[model samples]
Target: MSRIQANLLLLVIALIWGSAFVAQSQGMADVGPMLFTGVRFLIGAAVVAPLAWREWKQLARQGKTPTATDARHIGGLGLLMLVGAALQQVGIISTSVTNAGFLTALYVPLVPVLSWLWLRQLPHWSVWPGALACLVGAFLLSGAHELNIGVGDLWVIASALPWAVHVLFVGRVADKLAAPFLVACGQFLVCGSLALVYSLFMEPVSLKGLIAAAGPIAYTGVLSVGVAFTAQVVAQRYAHAADAAIILSSETLFAAVFGYLMMGDRLNPAGFAGCALILGSMLVIQLLPLFRMGRHKPASVLDHPV
Candidate 1:
């Protein structure tokens, strides 16, 4: 895809992801967090599996079969990614949409930290300020004035750790895998399988919850995981990974907008101020080098993490 096309696709992905926050928040009213995750992931897997299969067929038609070792490596990477998605879904339901959105976006900055720790890869120092800005944005966006981090907030934070790992690996898998579709398929299958096992062993899968949450669950599975995630996979193919991460991070903006427009959420003046700060912080991270130092190209390999 051209850069413009990639950007447009990524924008749509961000929008879907943002809107899915609304679904996740509402879905929690009717289902247990883990159960909701299981159902949503299963649905997402079902939707994406066919696309991946078709993609594989296309590769076969072109007489291009990946080596067995390559397939296995990609599958393993994908499985790890699925685990991250499932955790994020479960975590989102446990937390507020704003908190979930901002905390999740932290994975973008967290990517470099993890890379530094695991691979000894030193991202330029500029990423530090962006990391700080993301944290401040999280605090503001979560409205953490009360200083009482709830159970849900803790869950969201837990979700961030795996998210960071998944993102780092996504950058890896995207670079070598047979495009995004196969990677997405393998990832969702692992997630769905784990969710199914958890549902059977830990929680009772209630038909009542499924019946009640049908709409929200479907919305999340289809738009959030299916369409949005697919776009993320394909879009990252072209944009600088950092730029992609920055663009995808705009899901917070979409979530806030959808919250207000769809659910009649009202933001007080204080909330509005906090929102502005988060937006400014994200923009600064994206445009910092462009205006100031004129340092390096923003195209870090870690761009646009999950």
Candidate 2:
């Protein structure tokens, strides 16, 4: 797929995830965050297992075997997912949804920074301005009038590091893995298992709460985790992590739109401006590469269509 197509897939993921924010909020109302995360991701694991099995069988037919190194990479990805999700869930309980959403998007800028530090991949020139715009847009979309670093905000901020790492890891491993579905399944299983273990030991969990949050859990697990996350793993193979992160940051805008549609929450002028800025960032990021490539011959893989 082309970079543009990959970006479109990520945008769809943002939409699905954004709309599911309400379900996440409702799910947390009756259950501990850890327990809720465990159950929902377990559901996601179950939903994706068959697809992973099919991929495994195809690889087997092709005489390809997964190595221990592949297992280790998958495990690492899972651990990153677990850390980011746990922190976000805990932070969500202590912060407003708007705060959680906006703060989580700090990963947009963080992705490029992490990539530069770990992978020695400098972000495209466009990424700096695009990420900045997206961050500001996310803030406005969140409807926060003041910047306060609460415990929850701190947790969310910490979570962004793992999330940024996760995006880079996905981009790295997606090409190495035989099938992205298997990577998704493995990560979900690991993340879910970790959360389940933690919930059993530290959190109050009950079958009753699980049943109470069944609808939300199923929606998030099946659609958001299973489908959307798998799309991310597949798409990132074709897109720059920094660009993908900026695109996904538009989730806050989608969340605002969904909030208005589902809960009768109205967007103020700031929210509308936020929406415009995010869209503008996307356009800039998309077209800037093309313009630069036109002026000068392509110098790197990213300069060409995938």
Candidate 3:
């Protein structure tokens, strides 16, 4: 697929994820975060299982042998997914959809920073301006007027690291795997298994509660995890990781819109301003690369290696 097509797919993923915020928030009322995430991912795994199996079978027919390193990477992806999802689900319970969405977007900037720190690969100079904008926006969105941060917001912020790592890892692995669906399935399976273990030991899980939240669980599981995540894997194969991140980050915008329409969510003036800044940052990051590419002597590629 072309990069533009891949980005469009990422945008669709963002919309699905943004729409899922309400479902996830509502699901919390009837079940614990761990239980909800566990069940939701299990459904996601099941939804993708047929495709995953087909891919695996096709690979086997070609006499391809999976390596230990591949298994390790898949395992790591699942663990990262589990951590990121758990924190995000729990964080949403105490924060507004607006707050959660903006805060979660901190991952966009964090992605480049993590890349620099962990991989020793410096991001394009343009990243600084966008990252600065996002940082300021995050502070403002965290109730800068009141000079306080919500606990849930903190959790969401903490989750950003794992989310960034997950995206980077996915970018690294996207080209290495022949079966994106199979890899996605492995991730969902491991994530769901871990979440289930946590729910079983620490959270109270009831069939009645799961049934009560069936609509929400189904929405998040089937669309958000199953379809959106699979799309992400495929999109990343054709698009730059940074571009993919920026496109996926539109989830914040869609989440805010969906939250306002569905849940009567309203942010104060400062909060709105913060959201605007964050949106601006995303646009800046996306456009900077185009500008650089147009120059006679481009300084660096905006799409840095993952």
Candidates 2 and 3, the one with greater lDDT: 2
Please state the error at residue 86 of candidate 3 in Å. 0.7
Error of 3 at 176 (Å): 0.7
At residue 51, candidate 1 shows an lDDT of: 81
Weakest 10 consecutive residues, lDDT, candidate 3? Answer: 297-306
Q: What is the C-alpha RMSD of each candidate to the true structure, in Å?
A: 3.6, 2.6, 2.8
The TM-score of candidate 1 is 0.83
> Candidate 1 at residue 276, lDDT?
71
Name the candidate, 1 or 3, with the larger TM-score value: 3
CA-lDDT, candidates in order: 0.69, 0.82, 0.80
Best TM-score goes to which candidate?
A: 2
Which stretch of 10 consecutive residues in model 1 shows the poorest summed lDDT? 297-306
Candidate 2 clash total? 0
lDDT score, candidate 2: 0.82
Residue 77 in model 1: lDDT: 59
Q: How many collisions between residues are there in candidate 3?
A: 0
Best by lDDT: 2
Candidate 3 wrong stretches, greater than 4 Å: 135-145, 267-275, 291-306
